[model samples]
Structures are given as C-alpha cells and as structure tokens.
Target chain A: MQWEIVIGLETHVQLSTRSKIFSGASIAFGAEPNTQACEIDVALPGVLPVLNARAVEKAVRFGLAVDATVNRRSVFARKNYFYPDLPKGYQISQYEIPIVERGSLEIVLGERSKTVRLTRAHLEEDAGKSLHEDFHGMSGIDLNRAGTPLLEIVSEPDLRSAAEAVAYGKTLHALVRWLDICDGNMQEGSFRMDANVSVRPAGTTDFGTRCEIKNLNSFRFLERAIEYEARRQIDVLEEGGTIRQETRLYDPQRDETRTMRSKEDAHDYRYFPDPDLLPLEIGADSLHSIAQSMPELPGAMRNRFVATFGLTPYDASLLTTSREFAHYYESACAGLSGTTPKLVANWMTGALAARLNESGCDITQSKVAPEQLRALIGRVADGTLSGAMAREVFEALWAGEGEVDAIIERRGLRQISDSSELDRLTDQVLAQNAAQVADYRAGKAKAFNALVGQVMKVSKGKANPQQVSEILRRKLALPGYFLPGA
Target chain B: MALAIDDVRRVAQLARLRIEDAQAAPMLAELNTILHLIGEMQAVDTSGVEPMSHPRDVAQRLRADEITEPDRRAALLALAPRAEAGLYLVPKVIE
Candidate 1:
C-alpha cells in the first residue's frame, strides 16, 4: 500500500540581540552556567519583564521580508507549566495574536519550488537548560539561557517527503542567516526545530493523527526522525493500531522516536495574558525604520542572480545559499571581460567550492581574491588556458602565487590554441599513430579520442582539447590523407 | 461550574499541595463559591467590550538591548538549597 508523509516544522530562532528578552542579562552562549542568569531571569519577586526593542525590530524585519502581516499590537501570554528549568513555572510567549502572521517561505525541491505557508511567527522567551547527567542522582539547572528571545516560526503541513522537509529547513536556515537575525548555529542550539509528522494512505484529504517530535536540532535528524516516525505509524496502522497524539522525542543515537513521558495534565498549558507586561505595540515609524533596515532577502537575491546573470534557477539557488557566498560570486562577476557569469558560477561552485570544503575555509577567507578568479576565468574563456591549465593557475593563485597572467607566463602553461601549432602537433601525432589513424578512417570513433590524447601529450598538457579535437577531425577527414583500409 | 471533592483534590495535587481528606469538602465549597462569583460576572452582557488583558491602558515599555546585569553567580548560588559547580541541584528530572 502506498503512503504519503506529511510534515510541518516549528523552528525556534534565537534572536541575535545582546541581552535577554525580558531582562538586562547577557544572552551570550558558552558562559559559565547560571552566571548570566539575573534576578529577573530567576523570577524574583516584584520584577517585571520589559520587552526588548531590537527583538521586536528583528521580528518585524522578518515579517516584512516574508510579506507577512506585522501585528501592530500583540500581547504576551504566560504558558504555565512546572519544570525546574523554568524558574517562573511558566514560559512567556505570544498566544492568540502573534507578532507576525501569514508568512510564506518558498522552498525549492529539485527543479520546482513550493511555498510553505507559515501559520505565524511568535515572540517568546526560551527556557533554561536542564543538564541531566553528572550531578549525582539529581538534575542540574542552569538558568543562563532563560528569557532569551525566540521567534517561533510555525509552518503548515505542506511538506510531503523527508527530502522536501529538509529542503524547507535548509531554506529557512539560510534565510534567518541572511537576515542576520539568528546565527543559524545548530550546535549551539541557536536555531532548533520541532517537526510534526504523520502519514496517511495515498490520495486522502483527511488529515491523519500527528505526533509532535520535539527538538530536532539538525536538518539530517529532522529528515531521519520524520521518515522513521512515518514508518512507525504506518506499521502501527497496518497492525490495526491507532497512533496516539502526543509529544515524542527523537533519539539520534538509536535513530528512533519514542513517546515523551508527561503527566496527564502536563500538556494542558493554561495560557493567559501575562498581566505584568502590557500589550506590545509597534508604531508605524518603527515598522518603517525596520522595513528600511531590511536586507535583500535570499529569495530576492536568488531571483536577481537569475535575471541579472542569466543563471539557471538551480545555480542561482545554490549561489544564494548565503549572503556572503552570493556577494563573493557578484564580486567576482564584477567587470568580467571575456567570461560569462555562468562560467564564473561554474568555477565558484565547482573548483572554488571543492577547495574551500577541503581546506575548511569560508568563502570570506578565500586566499584567491575575486579579481584573481575573474582573471583566471578570462584566460579559460579566451582559450589562453584549457580547463586543466586554468585549474593549475587557480591552484597557484590559491597558494598566494602571483596574478593569473604572471603564473601562466612563468609556468608556460598557456594552451596551444594557435591553429598552426595545433595542426603541427596533430600532424605529428597522426603520423606516429598510423594504425590508430587507419582505425579512425575505418569508422572507429574511439580512435579519435586516443588521437587527441596523443596530441595533448605532445603539447605537454597545454593543448586545448576542443582545438585538438577540431584540428584532428579536420585532418583525419582530409581527402588526400592515405587510408590503410581503403 | 461548581468544583467536586475529586476536582479539589486534583487541583491540589497539580499545585503540589498537601491536603487531608477532611479538608477536601470545605476546599471544594470555597472554590465553588469563588467560581459562582466568576460565573455571575460572566453572565453579564459585555459582548461589545474588548477583552482587557490589563487594567491600565498603557503599552509595554521597550528596553534597549544591553547587558546591564553583572555576574552574581556566587551570591545567587548561596540562595539555593543545594548548588555545586555553579549549577542549582534539584530532584532528578528526566524527559
């Protein structure tokens, strides 16, 4: 029987503000545990939570980027629950009316794109960390992370497959980084995802029961957890069992999802408006300022790469994965003479990307300057260097060697593109390998490539393969040439 | 809605309060009296009235994003019943 997977993601993006959402405490990660927790963070008596303006600004910036409705007035609510990590016994969040609503993110699946509709993006305070190990038989509570502002971006159940869900997640990660709102660091728990996964029989509109998978921090885990949970649900149904609507935890080590233990009333978070904080109101002036401060979002920049550089959507999408990467490509494309943007893209995504990965260097830390890359691409385009020779020059450039022209001149790696030089070389190769030439004249197509390889060997690997093939094709078909079989 | 003795016991348990069996009936009656007052208030026609989250009409004041708090870990840890290695120790809690 065929089954379809349905997934929706709730991503918590920790805003990059310096201070916590409610208090004046530092929200920097990796601090000594509980050192950053202030009196307000610990929920001392007579302390009130004052909303952070920069957090609101960043949230509105995101809302504007996604063309969502920025609610002018939104209220903070107290999500009441009991946990040692939650010093207040409640989490301050936005309910009923969030700060941003009805946003959509366009996720590219292979060649086609799908718009994942966002239910809402709410502002909330993150809970503290609970370290379960290494404290005898007791738990350790570090309230340092408490009250850090988070924008909980919730999406509708639009993803159909694990791959699609991963694509959506990666797209969202790139976007938050592009906006400079979140650092998009999964290891530090700056951005975390909770996936709602379920499966139904193919061609059914009735939604199946979904189990919420909590805290899948990595995209790989998100995909794997969803796939495993879907299979588990399908198995249960096939065995005449029903899936329970509850929260589950994904164990990455075991690669399985297990139901989280909760008291019967634990899920009932009796949310009410937080009486301490009044309604948060964003004025028109503030919204305008935030809109003006908005950066060129990833989607817009991707489209511009396509429209301006004539790149394929796929290439554009890959290039615009990060703002810095797109900037690097543009800087290289600037004042390009003989080469096209497509060629620059090939070199960037092909050679440069591989080298960067191998060396564990970011695009910003690239040793080869953008202008140097443009020059190298120009040599390839003008036939001054074959692809192989250009790669050699690229390596030299990457190694802090001199400019493209000087490297080519010093190494004598220029392609033998001159017609006469290639002709003489091809003639020398053809005469030396008359048996292969005879094979070629006898309609053996494989012999042609062997002949070109011989010419390249004669040219010391500098012969342009395209020119060698052309010269060899013309010479092999000559009427006056002797054909051994004929 | 009126509260039953079982409902009182459940609420007390949720709040982590200890109440004897003899106290349950009086607690239910008192909770029901408060609920009756709230129910009477709910019966009033306030259809056009906006749900007031706070009594005052003032919006929340925004705070500038700056770290004004200093490291008081030592002083704060002194207040906890059991703290070691800069972390507050509690009863073992598992997910």
Candidate 2:
C-alpha cells in the first residue's frame, strides 16, 4: 500500500527590531558573547520585562500580509522549562491566543499553486545560544541572542511532498522579506524551521503519529529531513511496528536523523499569564494605519501585472518575487505607458538578470539604473536599434560609458528604416548578385536570405533586416525577376 | 484546596532542586496557605468583574527599538563561578 506524507512547519522568524524583545539590548548577530546582553536580557533580579512596540508592529504587518485576523488583544504567558540557555527559567510567549490567527498563504510551484493554512503566529522571546565547542567537557552560554523577539509562525499539516515543503518555505521567505518584517536570513539563525513529519496509509483519514524534526537551519535540510523522516516512519510501520512520537535531530553530515530524546509524552509547561505585562490590546486606528501602510502584496501585484500590463502570470510572479526588483521594474516602467511591458519584463528577467549576476551585485547596487535600462528597452521597443545592438548599449551603460541615445549615436548603430533608402540598397544588391537572385527565383529560401544579407552589407549593416527583406521581396517580384507569381 | 507534601517534592524535582525532607513540609504548608486564600476569594460573588493580567492600568512600557547597552561581558562573566574564552561555562549539558 502507498503511504501519504503529512508535513507541517513551525518557522521562527526573528523580527528585525533594533533592540531585544523586552530589553534595550542589541540583537545584532556576530556580537561577542554577553556583550550586547543587557541586565534584563541576562535575567537579573529586579529587572522587569517590557514589550517593544516595533516588534509588535512587525507582527501586525506580517498578519496583514497573510490576510490573517490580527487579534486586537493577546496575552503573554510564561512557558516554564529548565534549560541552561533560558536564564529566566521560563520563556515569555503567547499561549491561549496568538496575535495572528487563521491565515493562509499560496505557494506556487510552477503552474500549480497550493494554499497552506496557518494555525497561528505567536510572539515569543528567543533563548540564548549554547556553545559546546572548545569548552573541554563543559558548555558555554552566549546570551547575545537571549530575549530576542521571534514571531513563531505555525502552519497546518497541509504539505504533501518534500518539494512542496521547500516551495512553501521559499515563498514564505520571500513574503517575510517583502513585508520588511524579517530579514529571513537563514545563515544567521534569524529564521529557523521545525518540521513535524508523519506518514499514513494512502486513502486513510486517520492521522499517524508524527515525530518533530527540530532546528532545520537551511532549506536543503528542511527538505531532506522531512523526506528522510517520512520514509523512516513508513519503514517502521511496514515492519509491523508503531511509530513513536519523539524529537529527532537532523545530522547533515550523515544526512540521517537520530533520536535526540525519547520524549516522555508531554512536559506540562505550567503556563500562566505573565503578571508583569498587561493584556496587549490593539485599537482600530492602529490596525487601520497598519493596513493602509502595507505595500501591495505579491499576489495582488501579480494579478495587476497580468491585467494592466498584459504580462503572463509566470513573468508577473517572477518580477514580484522581491520588493526591490518589483520596485525597480515599476520605476523603469513609469511614464512609459502603453509600451510593451513584456519587453521590460523580458529584459529584467533575462538580459538584466544575467548582467546583474555577472557583475556580482543586486539590482539596488548595480550601476544600471532603471532609467538607463528603460532607455535601452525603448531603443529595442521601437525600430531604433536591433536586439543584439541594444545589448551592446546596455554593456556600455553598465561600464559607465554613456547614456543609451548617446551610445547609439556615437557608435552609429541606428537602424536604417527609411524605405526609399533601403529600396536603393536592395536593388543594388540584386543587380550585383544576379546568380543568387536567379537561385532565389528558383525557389531557394537560402538564396533569398543571402540577398537580404547582401543588402545589409551593402548598406554597411545599417539597413534594418525586416525592412530590407520586405523591399527585396517586393522588388524581386516586380517584373525584372524570373517569375512574379509562379 | 491544600497542596500535598508529595506535590511539593515533585515540583522541586521538576525544577532540578533537591529539597531536604525537613523543608518539604514547610514548603507544602506555605503553598497551601496561598491556595487557601485563593479559595476564600473564590467564594466572593464578583461575576461581573473583568480579570486583569496585571494590576497596572498600562499594557506595557515599550522601549524604543534602539541598542543602548555596551559590552560588559568581562564584568558579567566574572559573576559566574566558571568562565572560558568570553563564555560563561557550566556543567556539560547535551540536552
């Protein structure tokens, strides 16, 4: 019997607030251990926790982006546990009700888009890091990350395959960055994921026991861990064994998972409302302002591109993946209305992307401003320059040589579109190449192309190929050729 | 409504604390006193009163999102009993 994989993700997005969640300490990564950790972050006595309004605004911004209902009021609770990294002996987090509730995101893989339901996104404080290396039989604590604000986004068990999980991850990564809430930097542990994976027999509605795979720091690990855990569960179930619910760690070196601990069912985290913080209540004015301040979401922008700009859904999605690129494209397309948007989209995704990669810079850092690119696109859109020549002008602009019109004029690369001038060039080529013209009359398409090339060469490659081909064909069929209609 | 002595010992174990046998009864009694007072308050008919998470009328005193602390690693780590390489060392903990 086939097995179905059920996967859910709990992603911790470290909000990019300038300070710690409840303290005025820096959360900058790569700081020395305990250097940025203030007294409150270190859990000193008599130090009380306070909320950061910027962190709250970021959470609200994310909620609006996902179309989730932003709970006007939410409560902070203490999650009690005994870990060396947790100096306070309990983590301040939301329990009974989260700030954001019941949102869904559309994850598109190629042409198929799937919607994943989110259970909730709660606000919480991060714990410090435990350093085991070079400690000689002891572990060290780096409280730099302690008390950092994190928005723990939990998704429903809706993903079916490893590929879908990865796509969803990438989409979520882009969305957070687009919202400017989280930097979505995986290398710095700013964004982390824990996947719960299980496998049940196909066509069954009953759920199977899931093992939580913790701390997948990278997207590749997220995909591999979920895949490996699913297969492992299926193997055990097939061998007449029951799957045990436990927490496992993904060892990337071996590409396998081992039991971290055989969890004794549930650790009753005695949760109670944190008496230090009052209930967080948002007003309608706050919600309205946040909603009004939100930039156009990717989905809305994608539809607008398709409807207004006449772009394919594929091109629209690609351009709107990042806010910077989307803004760049819009700025380039500004004031150039009724022009072919696909021209801009094609160059942005195709030639411009290749150039940006070659220069090893992002769109923001690239010297090629949107206006410069727009000028180049305009040359190609009209009959001023050929596509290949337009590329050369782009390179010149990238090298800070000159503007588009000046480069075209200085290099003498303008297309010869005057029919009368192209007619003279075409007639001169036909008269000089009588044998090839006879071959063209003999129904040789190659000879016809040769005549067009000859015209272009005779005009010193200034004549437009389309115009030359048209005038050449019209001239050949007039009366001096072998046959007009035969 | 009284807390048992065993309950106190269980909580102590969960908290990674080793309470002496003589201390367990007093801790249990102390916890029971608080519970008894709560039980007495539960008898009062204050159905319309809204539960407050904090006694203060304010939600939370929010601080500006700016880093105001400087590095005090050497001084703070000196407070710990063990230290190495700018890290506060503790007993080896794998889990």
Candidate 3:
C-alpha cells in the first residue's frame, strides 16, 4: 500500500530585539559566555521577569501580517524541564494562551499554491548552549543565549511533500524579513525549524507514528532531512517493524536522522502559569497602530509589480523577491513612464542579476547605479546604440565608474544607422568581393550573405546589420546585377 | 486528573531522564500530584480565550542590515570544553 507523509513545522524565530526578552541584558550573539547573562537570565533568586514591549509588538505585527486573531490577553506558563542549557529549570513559555493563532501562509509550489495554516505563534525565552567535547569528558555551558526571546511559530500538518515544506519555509522567510520582525538569518540560528513527520497508508484515516527533526537551519537541509526521514519511516513500517514516535537530530554530514529522545506530550511539560509574571494584555489601539506601520509585504509588492509595471508574473516575482532589487528597479524607472518598466525589468533580470551573482555582491553594493542603468537602456531604446553595443556599454559602465554616455563616446560604440554610410560600406564590399558579387549576379542568392558579412567586417560590427542588409539589396539591384525579387 | 504510570514514564523519557524501573512507581505518584494541580488550569475554561505567547504588546525590534563585527573565534572557543587552535576539539572517530 502507498503511504502519505504528514508534515508539520515549528519554527523558532529569534526576535530582532536588541535586548533579551525578559531582561535588559544585551541580546548579542557570539559574546562572552557569562557576560551577557543577567540576573533574570541566570534565574537568580528573587529576580523577576519583565517582558520587552518591543518583542510583543513584533508578535502582533506577525499576527496582523498573517491575518490571524491576536489575543487581547494571554498568560505565560512555566514549562518544567531539567537540562544543562535551561538554567531556570522551568522554561517560561505560553501553554494554553498564545499571542497569535489560526493564521495561514500561502506558498507557491511549482504551478499550484497551497495554504499552510498556522497552529499558533508563541513567545518564549531561549535556553543557553551546551558544549560537549570529545576529549574533555566533560560538558560546559554558555548562558549568553539564555533569556533571548524567541517566537515559535507552529504550523498545521498540512504539508504533504518535502518540496511543499521547503516552499512554505521560503514563504515564511520572506514574510518575516519583509515585516522586519526577525532577521531570518539561518546561519546565525536566529531562524530555525523543527519538523514533525509521519506516514500513514495512502487511503487510511489512522495517523502513523511521527518523528520530530530538530535544528534544521537551512532550507536545503530542511528538504533533505524530511525526504530522508519520510523514506526511513516508510521502510521501517514495510519491514513489519513498529515506528517509534521520538525526537531526532539530522546528521547533515551523514544525511540521516538519529533518535535524540522520545517525543513529549503537553501533559509531560507540567505547564502552569508562572507566578512571577502577570498575564499579558493588549488594547485594540496598540494593534491598530502597529498594523498601520507595516510596510508593503512581498505578496502585495509582487502583485503591484505585475499590475503596474505590466511585467510577467515570473519576472515580477524574481525582481520583487529581494526588497533591494525591487527598490533599485523602481528607482531606475523613475523618469521614464511608458514601457520603461519592461525594459528595466529585463536589464535587472538579465545583465544586472548576472553581474551581481558573479561578483557575489547584493544589488545595493554593486557599482552600477539606477540612473546609469537607465541611461544605458535609453541608448538601446532610442537606437543610438545597437542591442549588441548596449551590452558592451553596460559592461564598461559596470566595470568602471564612468557615465553611460562617457563610456559610449570613449569606446566609439555608436550604431551606424545612417543609410548613406551603410550604402558606401556595402558598395565598397561589392567592389572588394568581386568573385562573390559575380556569383550573386549569376543568380546565387546565398552570395548576398557573404557581401553583408564583408560590410560588417569593414564597419567593425558598428554598422547596423539591418541597415546594411537593406542597403546591400538596394545597391545590388541598381545596375546589371540580376537581383531576383530585389 | 492524575497522571497514569505509563504517562509519567513517557514524560521522563521525553525529558531524557534515565529513571530506573524501581524508581518509576514513586515518581509516577509524585507526577500525579503535579498533574492534578496543573489540571486546575483547565477548569478555567479558556474556550475562546487567546493563548499568550509573550508578556508585552510591543512588536519585535530590528537592526540595520549591516555587518557589525567579525566572528570572535578566540573568545567563542574559550567556552568550549576542548579546543585546539581555532577549531573545537572532538574525538577522532576514523582510523
């Protein structure tokens, strides 16, 4: 029997706040082990936890962006657990009360769009890091990351395949970055995902045992880990073995997952409201104020690019994926109004993107300014330069800090659109290639291509090929040459 | 509302505790007491009430899109239990 994979993702997004979630300690990464640890972070006796107002607002912004219901009041609960990284013994997280709930994100996979609904987005303080070395035979702990605020966004098990999970991840990545809530840096562990995967028979209603894969930071790893886990689970069931529900770690080097521990139900955490802090309450006025300040998200921006600029959906999506690229493209089309949008989009997607990728720089860091890019496109539009010469001019402008007009003048890359000049070159070519010209007179239609090549060679590719061809045919029919259909 | 013995052992294993078979009975009894107390929370009837994820009503703060500093390799390695040169020291598994 065929099996279906049911996958859910719980992503921990480290809020982009400067200070710790519940304390005034610096929330900087790669700091001294115990230096950033405050009394609240270390869970010192009699120390109270104060919520960061900014962190709450960030969660609210996410709720509004996802069109989720924001809780006017929620309670903080202490999740009782004992680990070396968790100094508090009980991690202060939301249990029954969470900030945002019942939201959905639309992800485009291949040609179809899928809506991945969010279970909830809860706020919790992060634990410290545990260092285990092979030779030391001992473990060490760093408390710098302790008390760091994390917004754990949990998704429903609506994803079917690894590709769908990856598409959902990318959509979330873009949303958080666009909203400026989280930095969404996978390398920094600020944005991380824990995926729960299980397989049930294709037509069966009963769900199979699930495994949770932890600490998948990159999208490639997320896809690979899920694919590996789903297959592993299916193989286990096919072999007449019962699959165990457990938490697993993805060994990226080996490209396999191993059991870390058994999965926990909510009753296991012994969750209770923390007596140290009061329940969080927000007014409608505050939510409205934050909603007003949100910038145009990626989805709306992509729609605008297609509708306003008349660009293809693919081109618009590609350009609007990065905010900097979209801003640069818009700035390039500031002065020109008509069809400049399509022209600018082409240059950005083609030459500009190629150069940026080759040099390993972002659009903002590239030396080519929007105005200069517009100038190069203007040359192509007005026919002062052929499409071929405009590319060379773009390269010159990109490599050097020279204006488009200056590069055009210095390289003498102007197109020869003048019919008179082209005619002279064509006639000179006819005189020089006498054998080919006689062959053309003797009704060899292919001989005319050789004459056009000679004109281009003489003009050093500066002559317009179209104008040269037109002038060549006109000159060939002027006298005793038998120019058929000329 | 008390937790069953199987539930207590499951929770212990989830938390990575190596509880012996003999210790399971008493631990199960203690866990039942705690679960009974926590069960009081369910009695509050939070049917339509939203769950609180954080404390305050403020949004998340942001930083400028700029690389501020280099990775402090030496300082970070100092926290590791074992380190040699710039890399963390681990056991050699391969021959």
Best DockQ among the predictions, by candidate number: 1
TM-score for chain B of each model, two decimals: 0.93, 0.78, 0.62
Q: Taking the tens digit of each residue's C-alpha lDDT, what string does model 2 give over B1-95?
A: 77788889878877789999999888988899999999999999989997776777776556678777778788888888998887889888887
> What are the TM-scores, per candidate, against the unseen true structure?
0.96, 0.85, 0.80
Winner on DockQ (2 vs 3)? 2
What lDDT is reached at residue A42 by model 3?
63
Per residue, candidate 2 scores C-alpha lDDT tens digits across A243-265 of: 88899999999999989866673
Q: Which ten-residue region of model 2 chain A has the weakest summed lDDT? A: A477-486
lDDT of 1 by residue, A262-373 (tens): 3354456779999999999899888888888888888898889878888888889999999899999989999763338899999899999999999999899999888999
Ranking of models by DockQ: 1, 2, 3
> Per-residue error at A166 for model 3, in Å?
2.5
Off by over 4 Å in 2: A1-3, A235-241, A265-267, A416-486, B1-13, B19-58
Candidate that beats the other on TM-score, 2 or 3, i.e. the better one:
2
Question: Candidate 3 lDDT, tens digit per residue, A180-247?
Answer: 88888799899999999999999887778889999999999999999999999999999999888888
Candidate 1 lDDT, tens digit per residue, B1-95?
Answer: 87778888887875668999998888888999999999999999999898887889989899899999999999989999999989999999886
- Clash totals in order: 0, 0, 11
Residue ranges of candidate 3 with Cα displaced over 4 Å: A1-5, A109-112, A134-136, A199-208, A234-242, A263-267, A426-456, A466-486, B1-95
Worst 10 contiguous positions by lDDT, candidate 3 chain A = A477-486
Tell me the tens digit of each residue's lDDT in model 3 across B1-95: 67677876777776678889899999988877777878887788788875554465443333332222243445656655665534444444220
